[model samples]
Target chain A: MRPAKTMKIELKVNGKRERREVPPSRTLLELVREDLGLTGTKAYCHSGICGACTVLLDGAAVSSCSLLAAQADGAEVTTIEGLAADGALHPIQQAFIDHFGFQCGYCTPGMVLLTKALLDEVPEPTREDIVRYMGGNICRCTGYAGILASVEAAAKALSTKD
Target chain B: MRPFEYVRPTTVGEATDFLREHGDDALVVAGGTAAVVMMTLGVLRPDYVVDVGFIPELGPELDGSRSGGAGLRLGALTTVRSIERDPAIAGAYGLLADAASQVANVRVRNRATVGGSVCYGEPQTDLPPALIAMGASATIAASTGVRTVPLAGFFEGPYETVLQAGELLTEITVPLPEPGTFGCHAKFTVGSPENKPVANASVLVRTDEAGRCVEARIVMGAVGPVPVVAEAAAALLAGEVPDAKLIAEVAARAADATDPQDDLRGPVWYKRRIAAVLVERALSCALRKAGNGTR
Candidate 1:
């Protein structure tokens, strides 16, 4: 039998520093959900076609399922669990509830994280911008109308709060 | 997925040396977007995954030292998202930027590297056709020495590149189009915008002050095993005033150059027809973009 190889990686997950010894094949999704117990990041299409495993890697939205934990070493990772502050729902998360952003809620984490990334980049995005930027995060339910409204509401809410 | 040992080298030289020692057993990954997916699907089972993402020299940089000559140097690790958003690149190579923005989606673009995209040798991609049309060249690093290859001749076949074992694609240099030169990329997707293109065309046309075609380069993607250059189509446009009739003929010739395969995107015949229409659209768009500054 061949001996399995493991590599030690250190990364900042959700503003908390984390260190782990993971195998080369261990994906960032696996590390976050299994090892770190952060299951908020879902894994859907591991081939990167679907955005169910989206997360913020150094503030940019990326598919965590297609990324290796070892590859993210020394980088900062922001999962869905990182969004809120001190027992409060993030404005983006609340906006989803206010606007029915999801139905089954399977793709909410990715959609919310991607929304965070889009809003951070484009503070005041037009409807067209919202549609284009959020095209990657697919939701089989809610038909995306609610998601679009949620994103628009989130943008407005975030701006007003600021 | 098969288990493998991961090795991260902080320098290109160190990465090449490790690759040389391991030979085919080592697979070099830049962004790990494609590699990780392949690894998970059991399509790639390398014994050693040599990650070059840690190599600072290969990281993102937009060196315009050749700005005097209107050339640009892009490091291997330049993400597709950066190419789409970088003002400098967007200003000089808008066609490349537009094509980069069309790749997969925001999440994939955030992680996929330009070098990784080219090295992956996927025919149904966007960047290669535009890069080929822009007359790009790849700088490859090896333990033996360094070499440069024109981007047009880089691909050997589907999922294959001319890069030998232990070699690394370190940089891509694009010679900016001359004045009065305009380019456009037209892609036909099956349904969704993020889906792989069924047939795509990139046309770069340079016209003289009198509106006579001085040079033209037409490249087709997703309709061939590799990015296919429509030499005959380009030759037809050379020294001619591009009228609708001439453009139509050129587009037909461009379609003739394609060798598409039946895939989930579309069948071969449909791809050929779509390729022709896309070529026509791209050529017309490029001609219209000349001195107009509207794409």
Candidate 2:
């Protein structure tokens, strides 16, 4: 009915294709942070409700904790590590830094990426829309005003960049 | 989480074969939002997880160019966010797009597929009522091959589906109502300042050239094991402009007919009261849009 434990998984992480044997019981979050040693994608709740474990699976945001490492075969994954290019932060990441969008910086990675995605799609999202889209991303520090401001500013920056 | 073998079958046939063999001990995970959460909580202990995410046959099916009498034929894998952005879908099925736009959050919506939401078969889920109001149907595939089930007859009970052990949902087709028709969905979620509908109401109302009510479909979500259709409510509003008297009468019938359980959102009495308020507002919204379309 099921394999014993370990399973072979192939994935493209951070622009590099990798093949590794991982435990069937291990989550994608564990494999990302422990086995592959890419810790930029933070693991907070280890549950689907928190957005701290968010990662881009084929350009879509998904909680890594909720996925099995063995299920990632032949799939392309991009963590926070993959966002910046050539040592320069992506615009959204840069916007967070400029706007001081974080206090403890635990939720910043996921929030920044989520904001980048929403602004990429919505462009001129209203304040209500921004809040609604970011509902699942919990920010315990900084009270979310700066976070919202950063996203709005980033949206303006992104629109001008285009 | 229980230790399990996670298999990714690239094709539908392969998935079907795997499900047929391992149906009893296996769980088919598409988005993994629910399954993984359940596994971590030890709520589910399936030994084998057959992932349906990578199957090409179940990808988002959107019509890019506007075609006549055309609506969306959404593949089971189409994410809620993807549905929200599709131009033709927004133009034709605004109520669905509205519902999709408001589901979960950017993180969850990106991973939550339309098929997954419908297949959830949860009585309180937000999609079934909207789909029923829009006349949506799904193509389910089993060992016997493909068959279409109207969104009406799909759900059997809470967390229960008419889907057989090895059956797979392939597609969901939502018919676009007549151009002049209007649809609205209002949900009520507690402790949310955003005025997000707590006990959502999804309604479809239309009018003829003379402003007479042509047809109507009013469905309430989050109140029953399945989205409840208001047949009597529809009959009362048919062939009539939705006036205050009609709205009051429909509201009264809804309060009497609906069997909503008391839960966190509100007590049964509160829900009954909100349903009356919501149904009237929903009716006005639909009628306003129909009037606007005729203008």
All DockQ scores? 0.57, 0.49
Best by lDDT: 1
lDDT of 1: 0.89
**lDDT score of model 2?**
0.78
Off by over 4 Å in 1: A1-4, B63-70
How do the residues B1-295 of candidate 1 rate in per-residue lDDT, one tens digit apiece? 7888778888888888887888599778888888999989999889988888888898665544533365878889999988888877776688888788888889999889999999999998899999999999999999999999999999989999999998999999899777777888899887677788898888888888778899999999998889999998899988888899998999998899999999898888899999999999999998888747554
DockQ of 1: 0.57
- Candidate 2 lDDT over B1-295, as tens digits, reads 7788777777887877777887788788877766777888898899888878888888754555322476668888888877767777766687787677667666667777888888877676667888888899999887658889999988877788888888888888887678677877666667532223446677778788887998988888766667778879878987887788888888677656677887767788887788777677777777787888831
With a 3 Å backbone cut-off (N, CA, C), the pairs that clash in candidate 1 are: none
**Candidate 1 lDDT by residue in tens digits, A33-80:** 999999999988898877999999999999988888988999999999
DockQ-derived CAPRI band for the predicted complex in model 1? medium
Per-residue lDDT for B8 in model 2?
A: 73
TM-score of chain B of each: 0.95, 0.92
Classify candidate 2 by CAPRI docking class: medium
